[model samples]
Target: MSDRFELFLTCPKGLEGLLIEEAVGLGLEEAREHTSAVRGMADMETAYRLCLWSRLANRVLLVLKRFPMKDAEDLYHGVLDIEWAEHMVSDGSLAVEFSGHGSGIDNTHFGALKVKDAIVDKLRTPTGERPSIDKINPDLRIHLRLDRGEAILSLDLSGHSLHQRGYRLQQGAAPLKENLAAAILIRAGWPRIAAEGGALSDPMCGVGTFLVEGAMIAADMAPNLNRELWGFTTWLGHVPALWKKLHTEATERAAIGMNKPPLWIRGYEADPRLIQPARNNIERAGLSHWIKVYQGEVGTFEPRPDQNQKGLVICNPPYGERLGDEASLLYLYQNLGERLRQACMGWEAAVFTGAPDLGKRMGIRSHKQYSFWNGALPCKLLLIKVNPDQFVTGERRTPEQRQAEREQAAYDQAPAEPQERQYNKNGNPIKPAPAPVVEQARLSEGGQMFANRLQKNLKLLGKWAKREGVDCYRVYDADMPEYSMAIDLYHDWVHVQEYVAPKSIDPEKASARMFDALAAIPQALNIDKSRVVVKRRERQSGTKQYERQSAQGKFTEVSEGGVKLLVNLTDYLDTGLFLDHRPMRMRIQKEAAGKRFLNLYCYTATASVHAAKGGARSTTSVDLSKTYLDWARRNFSLNGFSDKNRLEQGDVMAWLEASRDEFDMIFIDPPTFSNSKRMEGIFDVQRDHVQLLDLAMARLAPGGVLYFSNNFRKFVLEDNLSERYAVEEISDKTIDPDFARNAKIHRAWKITAR
Candidate 1:
């Protein structure tokens, strides 16, 4: 009898149809969509083929056994009943993963442990030895899923998530997940669209996921073609010869039909940081020749004269999640809409937005909306009909069109001048006259010379600070040409101000001399005695002085009265402590009076010290580097805190999941864009914020507050969160003097009662 195997392919929700299509394309006859999953019957050979080619699937699992499970014990026994000896070597490494449903197995880890125990116990009893568990890189991955009192045990054939397509050598701030990108493309009808030679464009394509996925679809290439490994390849039952044959067949098919270049697939992003990643991803996907990526703003994107084929534009623009400000996003969307209406005649456009409210500002009605998940947060893909010939070409006039026409007619009908209006004494109409331009005297050469002298003095002060081993120091004399400002940094404390210099010479000269004298004080006071490191601040162009008069330095010390730190106020406008975290601090102080606290990305440990002072029993801080953690410790010590605080130098997400201790209060403030060498993956505030929140919230005390904040100016709170927890924007209280009222450095929220 031919071997019959149950195969399941899991993907991000709403992409089941695409997965089914891919299965069919692979010659699987009975593919069907299930909730957030796809199930089908396939021979072992077909399973291998699907594993090698499917793009949108997160994992491909081969069912080994199925039985009615009454409880955890039933689950363990059901997993043991599988013919493990036939599919996995007794000595091979294995990892057990579980997804729980209604079997009273609410804890997935506990369920996974039960299954692991059963498998190991069964193997040891029969073979005298059992397979060891290897979480990092397992040889045989066992999946245990319980739903509706039934246990489904399967062998994970894809191993790691398929989204890690190996082609992305680099990434930008909040890159779209490869699988999610593929799903979006499939939902946009890429297979049919590509077959029709329809062009695709992503005007705001960051790192070119959409463009790469589009090119791959057009080229008929298997998503796993570039992947280095698959979970099935290591399975004991996998047939190497059959896998090789399937791979060869897929490659041959791709080569046979992918000879033509894709129909004008293009991507444009204004940020230079995204350019390199886009280039790298496109090249790694082998689509460099077929796809074109450029560094340009979405507002200015225009199709080339020769490549003006009307097609589809799919954009995943900044949804005010990572970018900031709803008002600013409206302007961007308005400009984008106008550009699309004017340039993309006969083309369709779709935008993926986490914020539906922002969708209203697009000034266009969506013909369709598809609900999908962008990394766990529910989002909508809005489809807009741009420049529809039936309406825009004047074949039909919708109500909106008629209203616009009427407004234009009314403007044209207004009288140019009223007959009863009298002329002014200057022979002009009585209406207000245009304001006259005012001219100011240009800077005299002496004044310019004085400014230059002041700058020289500041530079000298910087040099003096460095020479004196000052960890943080500012360069300024109150008498300089620019406003006199004091720059101070003892540790993480950065203070800047106009210096009131002691009067000894002409005001300007004395100011300049005061900076010179201040430069001498660092050495005289024996500051920066270690001479460990020194940095200089760069001045801004066109301005007579530094764009900022603040000090630019590092975290050198922390004190109770005030933390002393280095800052770069002039060169970069900020030294990092967005005062808005103050409210979060107050919240921590209130809750931390005697409980453990966990701070992720604990920069300067300002919050940690606050928690410690608030009488936190203890504190555990996790950050990517020891440098920042040490600074945090110093901040604690500076505040008369103690060594009782524990510090972990690693990725916060991974550390939190592995941590056994729960915290009463947790503060998570990740960088807007961080590419840490020590991290396993890139961290993006917009894309990973929700996942981070979930991770941190999981570790919170039953009544604890998970204070989460990000500096992404356009950050939009995930909407689906309302059902899970109470969220309120406490941004107003977090603001401080250092940050301007208009400058939205960060947004904070209190998450509790989940």
Candidate 2:
């Protein structure tokens, strides 16, 4: 091998620039950047050093030769020209990896096989003792890259990817690769921060990757110092003396670095399950003295190192997969921002997220953003300076001004020491200090009015709800036009739905009023603020309303009509059980004795559970969503009504058509509009009601009753059906007291065979 060997260092996409700088710093000569790779020249010593020190590279390839090839034969001869005896023993094992197939080698597998064949043929001895293939741990690993018409063959000097620093055997579900984590730190300016002896913290640290990587960078430690294996360990061209010299120097440097006072590096994770694993990883990285992880939540995250200390707050909060997930994740990002504002003022923050929009919702402005890829998912690193000017609040102030106000507020809020008083000879004092007055947060006038309205409603409805044994009900529904929202009490939890204010309304005022209402809710309801779940409601079409709003996957059990049903308050717009349908479900329970029942569009099977509780012989529920069906199954199992209750997953129209059984009672409450992909075509409740009802009525036995309902305010039943079957409007009877204020909540009817 020559003194200067051509080297190609590969990395994850979007880290090409960072890797180029890092490679040049590690003695790589004349470095040039490529897509996901950096090509340069380095000697054997530099190659070994890069393998041990390059934090951003996935692999280090030492180029053997670059030959032009027009066909597979040329590729075979090109590989054959290399001296196989000098690289590996005749009985050694090797692995070949080929990329960019072309020039009559249409398949990379064929190209690799041809290269291997050429080497094996040349290395075969008189006794046919040839080198065998060892893909895992080989004596030699050759990489052939066919670019355009030229073949570039090289030897792999890094065995397993350099990212496998050997400390992260256990990680969270979505772990950033070690190299990628290092790249993020470098881009976030952790190196410079560490050089300044600044602190570091990760609010959502998963197994302490960032803390360990930051500690390594700050402590001047090589990333792979503890790694026991390397690609060139078994290669014939390996230089043991030169590698030993570089390794000893790196070891001494690390010792000297560790002797310095450790920087204040810490990590906090919300998941208690990850606390021990994070500690284990840090211990493995030999950074236990510098980094500490604690079980904490984002809402309560406080990185209190030393007084007056400020540093980087880096976290990789989860970017949820579904659109509905944004609802919950929005609050997560908000809580993170709130903590940053309250506890980490004057510090810097770096938020890495796949959802840039969610990052924007953090109530902070990013001064700079860099695009990177987490595997195939493109992500963004938002760099923020946690100062007063970067806050999304309408009021703008400089950091100095905010600091002054904070200091003044602290001085003013400090309790005055009790005045020293003269005492008599007895133990009792002549005079005692007056008790301190604790001031509470004052609500706005509109908020007070809203709170009074809620109290009045709760006073009137609480009695009725207790008498009726209702576990869930709507307490207030847009009672005041200014406060256009629906508040529901589910057990101890409060669910508030803020109807999107009209575009004509001044948004700032509306937001202020909503904030006031939110502030008054927990106080009025006498519950903790953490128990409140809020969602913004807007006009929805098709199946958009059914889409998940959060990924909580949490279901709360509630009782109605003597049966237990499950409701997921955070995951969807509708909380499984519809309060307006409570009376209808009770009505079904009243008339379901000894009769067969069927429910179409049986969301969560609440109505079916009521029927089963009413002693129905059997209950059949059908819906298109597997998620709802699963929920319905849980409801059935919760009430011990699983055996005779049939839960079918399919389009209700198709299921009804395919059914031949007869039912004595049927109830259907469907969406106003649906374009679900599972169904063959679109369904508008107003347009398709007749066909849906006709198909459903075909399965109705003689004298059976079918109750069909919908919430479309402008719906009108086909008049001709009244002539075929005796039909009567039953909307008035089904409206419960909770839904009485909004009488247009749903319309219902009873159709029976004439």
The lDDT leader among the candidates is 2
TM-score of each: 0.54, 0.60
Misplaced by over 4 Å in model 1 are 28-32, 101-104, 125-128, 305-308, 388-754
lDDT of 1 by residue, 1-754 (tens): 2387888889887778778887888767678898779988999888887777778788989888789987777887787776677777777788998897667788888998999988887677454778899997898888978878888888899989888888887886667888888877777777787888888888888888888888887887888876667787677787888888888888987786568755788887755456777898888888888888876555457754343576778988666555434433655666576667667767778788888777766666778788887877788988777755423335357799789778756755655654343333223334333433323223444444544554565466544433333334333323434434444444433344443443553677745544443443333333332431222323322212212333444333322212232223333344434344655665676678767788898865777766766767678888876645554544543343323356678888788778777888888877776666778787777878888887887888888777788767767888878688888777776653323323365788878865
Q: Tell me the tens digit of each residue's lDDT in model 2 across 424-444.
A: 222223344353332335788
TM-score of 1: 0.54
In candidate 2, how many Å is residue 628 off?
8.7
lDDT of each: 0.68, 0.86
True-structure Cα RMSD, model 1: 21.9
